[model samples]
Target chain A: MEGCTIIEFILLVIAYFIGLILLGIYAHKRTKKTAQDYFLANRTFGPVILFFTLAATNFSAFTFLGFAGKAYDSGFGQYGIMAFGTAIMAVMFYVIGRKVWKLGKEKGYITPPELIGDRFNSTSLRLLFMGVMVVFTIPYLATQAIGAGMLIESVTGASIGWQIGAIFTMFVIMIYVIFGGMRGSGWTDVIQGVLMISALTLAVVFIAINLGGFEAANTMAYNASPELFTRPGGGDFFMPMMWFSFMLLWIFADPMFPQIFSRFYTAKDEKSLKQSMILYPIVVSFLFLCPVLIGIWAHGVGLDVSGQKDMVLPMMVANYAPGFVYAFVMVGALAALMSTADSQLLSLSTMLSHDLPFKKRKISEINIGRMLIVILSLFAILFVITSYNPREGIMGTLVKTTFSGLAVLCPTTIAALYWKRATKYGCIASILIGETSVFIFQYNILPTFGLLSAIWAIIIAIIVLIVVSYLTKAK
Target chain B: GLWWRQSEPLMFGLPFWVVYLLILTLITSVAFYLFSKYYW
Candidate 1:
């Protein structure tokens, strides 16, 4: 609504894009015309860079928009679930990342599907994983696009609709990622990570100063809605079993996400992976905290956040924040979204170009990877422009659906890595059972069996994997 | 029920749950550091 604020924000966004193009050119010079250079960045990332890229990729718009909005709508319990789940998931990385790194190095694996397919000696199963990666990743990618669009619309008003903003985001991401490859994405992630944190820190400081101090802000929020400071009432908030399921959701499925699992392949050494895992939860918890504080601030200011939950942060900043502060924060949100969307598209491109059955013998791997990135980026842009819905909060119903779908693949990965008895037939059975059960439970076609759909899916998958492995063992 | 799960006993002028989350995060970082040092 304010002229100066909108002008300053637009200028910052333009500056950010210019920065990304420069980074893309730098990455392009180093990028060789090979799969390893394009997809895994030649396995060159150390612990610190790995940590930043992973943290940036992991948080996404979901952290700032969806999760923060959830906190505003629900309560502080959203933070507890995410912070604790992430800690536990970090431990999973410790257990899994080292093994994956070693295997990737030894066998020259780039995607999770490639690793699993070779391990099980089954191409069909690998394709299944690739299918899951492409199908489920679209919404997550679209979420980022939708988030960027919403941020633009919130700041710029109806002059530029959110759909056009989303299209512009997709176009920008396609350029850097198609030219720069993984190195471009990884280096850009470092910048994006810093922007993401700075945005949150500035917003937090701005809100705190406006409300007198952090304590006063908390008091004001409590006065405005004491139940928002508590648990389990306002809107199906934090039921015990449901909370347990939400916690399990990320711990089990996040490591299987193509974008994250591929990072395990890029670690320079075992120690780098180990150290990153050790530091990950700490960094992410801090990142996660910033948005929750903003959410609480929104509530304290008495915004109608529940009705327009995703708009909480942007609306607050646009209405009340200092112009430059809002500019930096919006760019941070844009950087966060692009960082995530690029990573996911890169992973999807790797799967399509390298893992799929269709083989083109003549084309260079880098070209194919770049081509796939363009196609997938266009697909995502189309999805966002035609069907993008902001009503689906960042961490809300849609992400849960995606996570639940992805969780089915986790048992197959764990069993393939750890259990000698895990067979091709077993993995196939388990993946089908796990994925199908999520749909069944999610749509309430079957009883939930006293737990969430994801939990039920995991239970069913583990059982089916073991049973089929034993029964179908080689004679 | 866990004591920190309650809303009472606001620590440092914040809710018990919020303080509990910070403690949980600290414990997690420390535990992870130890794990990396010894086991990993």
Candidate 2:
């Protein structure tokens, strides 16, 4: 992977910034005055916009970079596990999104903590959920920062220092987010999201042409290793992982994950919510295939990316494609990176300002949101200098240990929503039991079963919440 | 595994560029129309 010209890199960055600045300014003017408007786009986002936002927002750096990397490294073995896990993630959205939207409307909830607090009718229970939320969120945020630095380095030939790159990336994002809220964030995501799709799609076409055709990728990936081609959950322990991935959706119970559920509360009504889910997965399935193609193509050609599997897209394009195609492809990779970074920075800052506060003291929620944008943007900056090396794939960073930790949250949330008898005591007991059990296994012991301890914790937690709430006559 | 990368010009009348953009458009159009009728 060589010869990314200085002129090409600068022009691309310039074009990107100009487009972003124009949108950010327009969105700033369009920005509404209320807290609800700032955080949730005043609940006015339509179908296409919300679908792109969810796809753009949820499909983080990990998908763009790490998925390719893992495919390069482990090939089909990783694909089956990750692909199935991700598809299940979408299904979870359908089942949980409707319920969360319904409850959110009735309760007027703002963050995940709000759901927990309202459901248990207790401050402490909400606090427990909040703690888990913050801890898990940091790593996810760090993954974005790590991605930002890599994008700059790849295009610029590392001419810019890590500190300088971090500043520029964060500064552009913070200004728009601070001024415009979801209006700015949403609009920018549209731009970046489009760029992302264009870029990845371009790379796929280029590689597909070079490698022969669409079938070549899968054929090569399989002939290289036949065992890897099967569906992910079709194996011995596949059900457990599928169940683990499926159950992880209880995060819908958390109100602060503004990327998706915020759409629910602000949605014009239940119809938009239902419709988005029905069609959203089709887009996901289509977009999902592109990078996998690039990975398999790279594999066939012997484009060895070593440890940093995440760099497969950039490396393949740079090493193999025509210069024009290379420039265009970089846009998609950067698009994925920026789409995720911009929205997340906005969400993270909002949660800190709005959710962290004990009470809404007369502070203009919009200004406070902007202020937190600047503060949290610094975290990405810190991650750049320290995150010079690729840590792991996107699945590693985004999913991580939290997938299991979420199991505990799931049982209580289900019991709360579907079962009226679920008590506050039951919620607390479930979270404590489930999360502790996950920690024990993640750190102390490897599970005899591949599914791990989180599932077990969730099972026990559900039993406890049900039995206790029934016995105590829960409120 | 043996097929040539250059053989296929477009996967379904749209090249990768056209295909992904089409996917994006189809989703947005359907969702936007529905959203307008229902929420907007």
Candidate 3:
């Protein structure tokens, strides 16, 4: 990129951060000085804000950049997997989200593990859940930093290296969370969500027009590689068993994600949650599928994205888009990264400061929550600096592993709400065995049965929960 | 079964998966609307 173009992109990014900080300060001024208000936005999110925040928090730049690259390399089957998987997740929101939201409001819960521990009446189980969450969440958090760095560098053509970009990204999110907490995060998410959806829609439409519309572009892609448009898809991306495992992972494990689960507590009413669910599949599909289409278009036009798959979308925008459009899309991509990072940082801090068995005699819970946000951001920045050079499909690998690990908690979460017979021992045993089995299956230490590790872990978890709960009833 | 493997007869210049997913999005949202109204 030329120096002028690089300057334009940098200025655009700075402008976006300025907008976010102002929103953060506004939220901070409006929020009450209480733990519930700081962490849960006093449970006052309406349907529209609830919908955008949840959708934006669920996806990261990883959805657009990483999914596009994966689809470009693996074929449209990956897109199908993501689109359908997300829709299934929305369905779960109707059943699980309502139950969780009602309990959260009645009991004044701050986090999911807090509800789980209180329901089972076990501090140890809560601590165990927090530990599992922190471990899995780190990589997912690091991906945001990595993605921000890659996006900035690609758009500016290495005028800004990914490391500095990552650092700046970390700083922006931390500042917002420190200032606004959940309210700030929610406000910023609404803006980012709208910007991202618009950018993706516009990017696809522009790319299609450039490549002679969707019909011609689809024809070109089909002629080049027909398998990409088919069921099994090119590159043998969709194996039957693995696809089944992925579907199961999305349906069961996604709601258990800390950031997503927090939205259940943040929603104001049942109708709001329901309205968010009703609108989610429609918005989410377009937000995700547009990038996949752009990726296919790039491939059809014969852009080589090998060895650096995750940067394909950025590369396409840099090459084909006008300077103004390039800067706007870059802002959108960074918005996606920051939206998720802010929520994850807050969720991690909440777990460490509140959900875990930590005494707050010396310091207030909200202050400790603020301190942990800085700590986690610094920790993630260090992880990003060390593990900067990830290989192809790194995004896909990190995301899948995180989901599988979180899936270990799926049975426990559901049972805590539904099964009165569930015991503390069963919950703890389920978590330990489920988490360990997920790692084992992840590394192929155990037989996978050609399924995802999460599937196996969940199977083991339910058995352990049942047998152990039966063997040792709750006193 | 080749039920999912049918990619030749394209719909609206898109292939099977693209059309199927687009249609699936509409179906899912409508289903969610009804489920939320009555069942949920």
Q: Residue-pair clashes per candidate, as listed? A: 0, 18, 0
Off by over 4 Å in 1: A1-3, B1-5
- Write candidate 1's Cα lDDT for B1-40 as tens digits: 1242367766644678777777787688888889889887
TM-score of chain A of each: 0.97, 0.87, 0.97
**Lowest-scoring 10 consecutive residues by lDDT in candidate 2 chain A?**
A229-238
Per-candidate DockQ versus the true complex?
Answer: 0.57, 0.05, 0.66
Give the per-residue lDDT digits (tens) of candidate 2, residues A161-245: 5456656766777776777677777777777778887777787877777766667655665455432333231132224454454
Off by over 4 Å in 2: A1-4, A77-85, A91-94, A161-163, A217-258, A357-362, A387-389, A444-448, A452-454, B1-40
Taking all chains together, each candidate's TM-score versus the true structure is 0.96, 0.82, 0.97
Q: In angstroms, how far off is A37's CA in candidate 3?
A: 0.5
lDDT tens digits by residue: candidate 3, A244-359: 77767788877878999988999999889889888877886667788887777776788887678887887777666666776777788888888999999999998888876665
By descending lDDT, how would the candidates be arranged?
3, 1, 2
lDDT tens string, model 3, B1-40? 0146667678756665566776787688898899888887
Q: Model 1: per-residue lDDT, tens digit, A219-239?
A: 888878777677762476677
How many residue pairs in model 3 have overlapping backbones? 0
List iRMS for all predictions: 2.1, 10.1, 1.6
